[model samples]
Target: MGSLHPAEKPKAIDLSHHLNNLSRSRHPSPLKDILKYMVQPGMISLAGGLPHPSLFPFESLHTRAYAPDSNLAPGETKHGVVDIHIPQTSASTSNIAIALQYGPGTGCSPNLVSFLREFTARVMQPAYADYEILIHSGNTDGWNKIVNLLCEFGDYILVEAHTYPSAQALWAPMGCKGAPIAMDGDGLLVEDLRRVLANWETDHPGVRRPKLLYVVPVGQNPTGSTMTFERKQAVYALCVEYDIIICEDDPYYFLQLPAYAPPASRKQESQQDEQALLASLVPSFLNLDYQGRVIRLETFSKTLGPGNRLGYFVCNPIFAERLLRATEVTTQTPSGWSQAILAELLSAWGQSGYLTWLRNLRDSYAIRRDWMCDLLAERFDLENSPVPTEGVLAFAKGHGSRADRKQLFSFVQPKAGMFLWLKLNLIGNPEYERLRAAAGPNVEAQWNEAFWMQMIEAKVLLTPGSYYTPWEGRDPSPNRRKEEGVTYFRLTFAFESHEEMRLGIDRMARTFELSWNLVA
Candidate 1:
């Protein structure tokens, strides 16, 4: 065949319009609201789950960072290599160059695990000492990898009744199921977990147990519920008894109440007080892991900044190898720049200083926590009021039906993390169409999609409740059979300022009033 001439070459076909459909599957843009309301300005937005940049030690990092200690001979440099513990406001100019380079797939070039190791030792001790560690892009990445490693298509995983939405979303596409065990305000109900597991076993004898048990054992997302030490012990015992792996996804482990903050910098502070500081802090599941079964996921998204997209997991060497293999195939690793910056920050912070920083973060979040809770309590007539709140998020129940949720969706003002989880009352008939209309396009295709659509169309976005089900491929087990009982939505508060949070709440209240007025 003769070669075609330049003029004869077919004009390049454009598929921009056709490609628009793909955007539906993509993540909600952080800047979506900004784009939507570009012309009309608004107040501080609690709509995003974001960390305050003002709180970050930007000045400190700009001033005191050390030179590339990786290049220095161990004993040769007393002048350039800054010890990880001593806080620095800036680094040598060369340190900036080091951060700009591409990082290894595993994480920071110098490795933050050293500090993590020391911190793990001082706090976690003998149990976690022997466990292996692997760094990743973020907690979500780590969580996906853990599920990928442990679960085959259609396998089941366990979660709390109301839990983190992103994690639930991650499992949905893989044909995996989430069997939501009931939860109390404190977190996953241990007795419920025990009963559910026993029931599953009784029902399906020889088949595999759940691929993993996922829980945010500390300062849980949405609910901002922290697991008590007693609860932790009970849950841990169940995992041990069940021979199931526990994926401990605690991004809010450090954002506890102000009472947990370490001692202030003062000349006369005693050693005894330091010991007390360490003892009083809430313990993590990894801290109590007698076996390597507990996989601890750590993230810089909360304390550092969500934009950083940095997180790590500590567990058995075997699991680490599997996670790394999965990382190679899936995400290929987190952002190189993010990994480097995080490593540099952690390497400079060391164990004690890092703990001190975490305590400070907890104290900062506590103020926001109280402010948000007080606002909600004064305004919303929730079915069940909260106990004195501690963490960054809170859960509330409003009097409304699934239809009311569509109109009144946006009223929640969260105090912590990036969102709030709302459980609404479903009225009258239970049919998929009503949920489908409330949900959007996917209403008929995937049950969750409908719920998502309903909320999205209302100018508020939320993850659907169905994504948490443990129903598997073509054959969803009878125990995990899908039903139309969901009456909930998640809203984020971390992104907005106090003013924005209040505004979002006020707007939501109006939305509810309008919705209820129509229903009446």
Candidate 2:
């Protein structure tokens, strides 16, 4: 991959005004700042407390890494395995000695740091000339640093109506609230964002509009929506108009799969060259960002392993400096072991090999996604939605007559990420319909809980919708409140085997059939 940036590009717009007091007050750690001096040749320094690689207890670390093009399926390691050794001595550039030693928050190993920079520049291709990268201990740490850097107590921030719960939880203690914008299958609506920001005082009296926007554009957490290039352009334009900073937490960016094709319509998957693969995908917010207002939080968690706990930020230098200070006090960097291992593997594979691996992983997950959708089709009378949203499913099996058939649940077969966001149709279920009519308020919550408990009793586990649903009293839609009347579940095809997926889906289908009084 080559740079999408031109020879001359604009520098980032000064977004310093948006920073809170804490970020403005941040100063580089004096001891950490001295690190630039240690890297010089023949510099015999005893300035900061540092460990010698020879004295380190660990000698050699032997690791068998799956090759870049591994099948990534269960028991598919036979595809290829690359041997890696992290030597204790400083013989190699990214040896264990230096990795295991205390290092800067920016990164542990220069080799890994260099690798990421090239990866971001070549793959992510940020539009600006001066975009900088800062490594951290994955998206959680990355977001935490940003939260501390940008958020003052009692500030509001824009989030998807259905957003990541943990992120919202992280800022709540500081009195920051979520100003959730409406979303459809595509993602958070651009108009909704404009409406919120443009009419802040009128719509939300006693409080000002938010200055920060947190979004998971690719494979959004609960909704599994991926914003198209035009959609992102619109969203970015709105952010620019409103002077808002966009925080892109896209862990599943590489897990991007193709649109759903029924088996009959399926086409053979082809290997994509690096450039072709790059062209096929939607560019990141960073790529569209000329002003460097987008703070992209990317992670190896989705592609490699979550245990790696390695992620990085692509943002302007101003924000990077403040985030570095936050990291000094909290999670400094990813584990040295993680850095060394990743560096060795990445160095061996190189950029092209890694992209091949990502494509393979994407294809494998797509097959798993198809499998889950197939199971859903087998277990119920899954049909085209009446509304006819592409890639969406509606399932219902009436007792006998076709007229009795009603949509019990539906989901947009996600083009990215692992989870299927199943939207329940409570009005379609006869039992639920009768209850909704007879029972007064909160009936949906009670019934949904009871059904979820039944699924639990039947040995099926799923995350409840309420967990991802943003806190109430903020959304300005009456129809949006209708989401409350329905139940939802996030089913994953990432970890489980095909057999396990079958069993789980079987249990779920049976549970739905029995609970909804539908015929098999």
Give each model's whole-structure lDDT.
0.56, 0.83
Off by over 4 Å in 2: 1-6, 73-77, 390-393, 398-401, 428-431, 472-484
> For this target, which candidate reaches the highest lDDT against the unseen true structure?
2
lDDT string, candidate 1, 402-508, tens digits:
33333222222332243455554333224444655576544334544544564455565445544443334555456652334335555554455677667656555
Please tell me which predicted candidate would have the highest TM-score against the true structure. 2
TM-scores, one per candidate: 0.64, 0.94
Residue-pair clashes per prediction, in order, are: 28, 0
Instruction: Point out the worst 10-residue segment of candidate 1 by lDDT.
Output: 12-21
Candidate 2 lDDT over residue span 190-250, tens digit each: 9888877887887667976788999999888988888988999999998888889999999
In model 2, the Cα lDDT at residue 207 comes to: 79
